[model samples]
Target: MTSRAPAFPLISATGEAMRRLGRWCCVCAALLAAGCATYGPERPGEKIYRDVVFAAPGGHKLRMDIYVPRQSKPAPVVLWFFGGGWSFGSKGYHVNVRDLTTAGIAVASVQYRMSHTAVYPAQLEDCRAAAQWLRDNGARYGIDSTRMGASGESSGGQLAAMLAAAEGKSRIRAVCALYAPTDMVELAQLYSKPGRLSLVDKFLGGPADQKLDVAVNASPLNYISRALPPFLIIHGEFDGVVPLEQSERLFLALTDVGVETQFIVVPGKRHWFRLDNTQFAEVSRFFQVNLKR
Candidate 1:
């Protein structure tokens, strides 16, 4: 969900911008982090690592918190991303993976460069780096690494889907996206509020109308392919922020390409709604079935 833009220093989109954005990102992250100070008491027999640096792109240190289950054998991992309209979000935001870890799955809540700090591919690149880091370092933390998946909401949802759909060696085995904007161009056009459109603008470094190529490049829908991993897409029935059609189109595109996918619309719900126990169970089951291979 988009919010009022914080005061950011004027910096050119260059090496210098990356450094400055890194600083600003920490500030925004700290503010958001305070809200998620406690995610319940730690589960028994669970191994937790916080603020583990996964990558340092352009001198910006990206981090993730890994929660490893107490399984004897190495367990599958799900890399989670957080949503903040690509402007500001913390790695700890909206993370609830107890079900996953309890089911013998590890969860890595990852942090990426926000749109206000960096442009489109930067976020993707940072996320990809996190995946690769997990692949390279997961063994040290009891993660299988071979069996990987991703899940996120809104903007983070887009990252998770794109990370899986985009062609790369680091692509995961599955993805679960919630109320994400799959089509950047459509999201920009559907914006009814002034601030909403600006979210797309700042993310793409300009208006989507002017940067059609960038907008297309940023869209997860355009990246759909048959080789992509299975997907579980959940959208609210009346999501005004990203709209239900966004997930619908992505589901259609994936299915058309012969990719395994499922679309579930939460009835009578709006954007920012939490999953009930049943819905959460479905998501947990989706990953368990698809990722355990």
Candidate 2:
């Protein structure tokens, strides 16, 4: 017969061909899995972004980390600055820096002037310039510049307050300040009072120095006007650095000018760290309404 007892099988060749096919399939699956893996700490509807050059103040280029939500067509933006007595702090802090992106809101964590180099209005100018950056680059960043807000803590909080109090047409929509120093003159005076509890001296320059005027120029309480934005102030009752009254004073000043402001006092908390779930949730909700579409 023509079949000739069947053809002798090339067992080794067939086996090797099957093995190569299996290996190729496995490699494809692995590549797909890698692509689908975790993008970052970014949560649903959020993304982690960085190093967006927001401005160039004093011939120096400034940068920020922006988190944009997927749900909103044109999301509201929250421009956040970190707290370090105006001498230190990157655009990363409060853990809020990351969470803001996941919540479907756009956030710009900024870097401004520090004490060792620039002070007072220098910081304010940088901040104002950051706002302008947001406004100018809103389309590129997927942000709704018309509904922008600001938030920060301690010296960072003071910067947020200043953003709200700035005299401009593109005013901030809302503000969130945590343990911010409102009255710089008052804080500067307290620096030499037997203790260094109020240490804004290094930030705005010392009271003994010509920094007194500089301090006054930076205080949020100095520029109270009806054109200010709504504010939410969170202060530790025992915050030795900025004092509880600072928030109260700023809240009152905003309210006096028919602007909306809310104050939350964290009992027994220190100048650094210690925000409970309630405080965290409060700020989160505030930003949801104010910073997210």
Candidate 3:
């Protein structure tokens, strides 16, 4: 039998390492538990007014859900739009509604006619009407109309951008768009390569070439001017539905015209990347800075 140096020493070392690792794991678990506890429950005073009609264009009653925060002073409002390719969506779903309201910001999730029911300008008109309604009736709900902003994801993002870019009395003071299409003509060109029309065509009621004027009129990029409000555009680098180039183009246009804009490109994320708590906090901070005046 070949006598080996005492194996006890190595065994003891391994045992000690295992014990240390066990202690480290316990600490980690405790920290995770503590973090989870911080997120305990929704705030008590957050209130949601459901299905309040804001407009009735073409006899189609458009309604919105207003989330009011419990604040001593009136809170700034943000009109939120949900993404559904401009053909399908509802105001019932919203991201960060509780978070926004908890941060002393009121949120209004607006309902608009989808492409299936109406095309192009109808959706924009409905959103404009909603903004107008919020501005006109803001006092009743403790909303500061002058400090209003707009935010949305995907198709909703496009509408939000349009609402901000529009040169009018009801234009939003700040805009945040997540993975929104900026140029309908560019989007149409990209989709035409597959020998099929894109949602742009559906929303515009025809191909870009056939509806050049309408496409130009509907694109947020076309409306970029010095008078436009501050814009925060966020897009995923790996977005397949709406290419990152779309956001880049919009950012370039805004900067070219001396418009205040911030563009964020999230890495390793696709079209539908769900924003985490930290990202939501950043968004809340953006609104707090811009909408809170």
Candidate 4:
């Protein structure tokens, strides 16, 4: 039999392939480690539970970061949703947890399905899930489940209203909606300018005129009733995104139903307001008065 030369070239090729595979594996491992990394800073003196999976809708895990006050007694909790017109936003950013927690209240910064994932009630469903989770398991985290409230800014503000309106089994005792779009149909009209993807359309999956029922159903105004919890609606006078009338319509509708509501207009301010602003104090006070024992 003819002797076969040692397959050194094959061995070298195999060795090179193994090295490349090892490098790729390291890159993937680093990415996964980063994915598991904690985000945002936790306020001092409060215990924070991050990435707590509250619900798994459509097999997708939804999480909330719960911040519990250091108080001995059970503390009231507020379900806060961040805003990016329901298209994009994070539970970590634009949070008022420190302010609320400082007032001896627990804060559950919740994550909801965005318009890109699902529409209308999907976002509301995730929010309601968080509220229900807090209501059920909050005591373990020093939360007084009986005094639960909802608050958010911009699109999240509208969600807070919807959640408070659709109280279901978990009754939200109070709501604070800042610069939220209350009337979707009207908002659709205001944003009818050509060449733009309206946020309302993104939320409802089409133009409000085409999806009238969905628009009406998505609107917090349509769900208002005497049974709703107290609402504090704050809008910026120069809020070019969601018109001032949106908040006014919601306030007026709530008042017509004899529901307790307050509408505050901040002069020269646009959509995003400061956490240190006096209006934010009103937010802290709203929850304090309505939620605190």
Candidate 5:
């Protein structure tokens, strides 16, 4: 998710912007030379040889960083989106996604259309196309078409939930959202801190700009249905940005429709939520269970 004018530099949408992801990948790859940040396979059970590509969304391309475990056979594919409140974030923002590849789950860290240049469904559509592209060619990527999951944090979480909830099993098998937002109306109203910076204006286009109905339709919460894939929501108890309640609504909504779902709230964590050792354990475990081939 990219922000609007005067917003933080989250992600770039063009080949130039995507170059940022490639640059980061090179940096991470080089860091392994000295074993400083051994992204190859330092620890026991890790992904290796992560590569970046740009998924085409017509004129604009969505950046994708694909990771497959070193020496691992055909496995599940996991599409991970970065979080920036639908305003900022890059596929490179989240580092641990590489872990999924090393853990026998092929990971694709994708960059979608952001709120900067466009708005609403544009972002959703770009992400959806990314998933479809992966599913269409899972075999070429050494992925097991039978098992595929999606994961993201914050706004990416909302997008992840939206993708999983909106699509039938034919597209995705499971979803993992980290402190994501579902109801935009409630989120725009609830997290609107009194005077802190807010990207809602740029994301929703403000009262004087576009319209609220636009945000509603693009929101993941509005499209919850039985076609949704299994879900795993992990939220922070004190996420001032996106509350835990949003996760509750999604978890409950999915379960009501017989969709396998799980919800976990981190105790005493805030917006810049860090994955503790335990959280990492849970993260790997969750993906393993849902992304099994």
Candidate 6:
């Protein structure tokens, strides 16, 4: 009881310290959450226009989902396609739409006829037509058609590459392909292992040996030239579906033809990998460099 007079002060000090610690924890948690939000797939305040018919091929309505950014003026547009090996996939499945839009870019997630519904050039045609539609109707959506870019993953990547390389009235200022098959003929040959041959064959409508011309026609490698737009080709090193060499060949061809290009080989990744913040930033920067000019 001799030192009891100071007990209240000690208890007050201890309570203050606990309060400070709790406040510090809350601040740290907030910072961590903000950091994670940057990389997270949360699309807030994005204006989405879904199921917009871009084309009607063979009586089928090819649609797209347009995600517009909150910008003062019209923003650059990036047309995105889904990967399904030309057999499966849709516009609803996209990764970086919010990230791109947040960076002042409008994103168009497109849909093309699958292999079960059509064939090689048919899918390519749908992509080209979608690009054309964006170019033609971009003004309505506050999009800068002249600053348009193309991007895709897997089979969608193939279509995106073709959109950038193939001849068209509207110009695709930049191209980004992720684990896509650049060379259909080469992919068909590489994936010729038993039970794998049907992947490419089904898309091409026949084997490479039987449909060599069609395969070449569908390959983005065959369309590379000096006139092509700047390209960023990203492929997984351990991709079993589309060989890494497909992107390598495309990168080599683009460089040999004097088209500005960059090839990134993701180590230890397979056909599909989760896109990190760095990859999203690279894509945003690539478009900003090529399109914002």
Q: Candidate 6: minimum summed lDDT over ten consecutive residues — where? A: 1-10
1 against 5, candidate with superior TM-score: 1
Predictions: Cα RMSD each: 9.1, 23.5, 16.4, 19.3, 10.0, 18.5
Q: Rank the candidates by TM-score, best first.
A: 1, 4, 6, 3, 2, 5
Query: Global lDDT of each model?
Result: 0.77, 0.68, 0.74, 0.76, 0.64, 0.74
Name every residue pair that clashes in candidate 3: none
Pairwise lDDT winner, candidates 4 and 6: 4
Off by over 4 Å in 3: 1-43, 96-98, 167-171, 193-197
Better of 1 and 6 by TM-score: 1
Q: Each prediction's TM-score against the native? A: 0.85, 0.77, 0.81, 0.83, 0.76, 0.82
Ranking by lDDT: 1, 4, 3, 6, 2, 5
Per-residue error for 100 in candidate 2, Å, reads 3.2
Question: What is candidate 2's CA lDDT for residue 38?
Answer: 26
In terms of TM-score, which candidate is stronger, 3 or 4?
4
Candidate 1 collision pairs: none
Per-residue CA lDDT of model 3 for 221-283, tens digit only, reads 888788788787888776656767778888878888777777777877766556778677777
Clashes of 5: 4
* Candidate 5 lDDT tens digits, 183-247: 77655554344443245545666541245686686567787777776676777665555555667
lDDT of 5: 0.64
lDDT of 1: 0.77
Which 10 consecutive positions of candidate 1 have the poorest summed lDDT? 1-10
Q: lDDT, candidate 4, residue 75?
A: 90
- Give the range where candidate 4 is weakest over 10 consecutive residues by summed lDDT: 1-10
- The best candidate by lDDT is 1
Output the lDDT of residue 124, model 1. 90
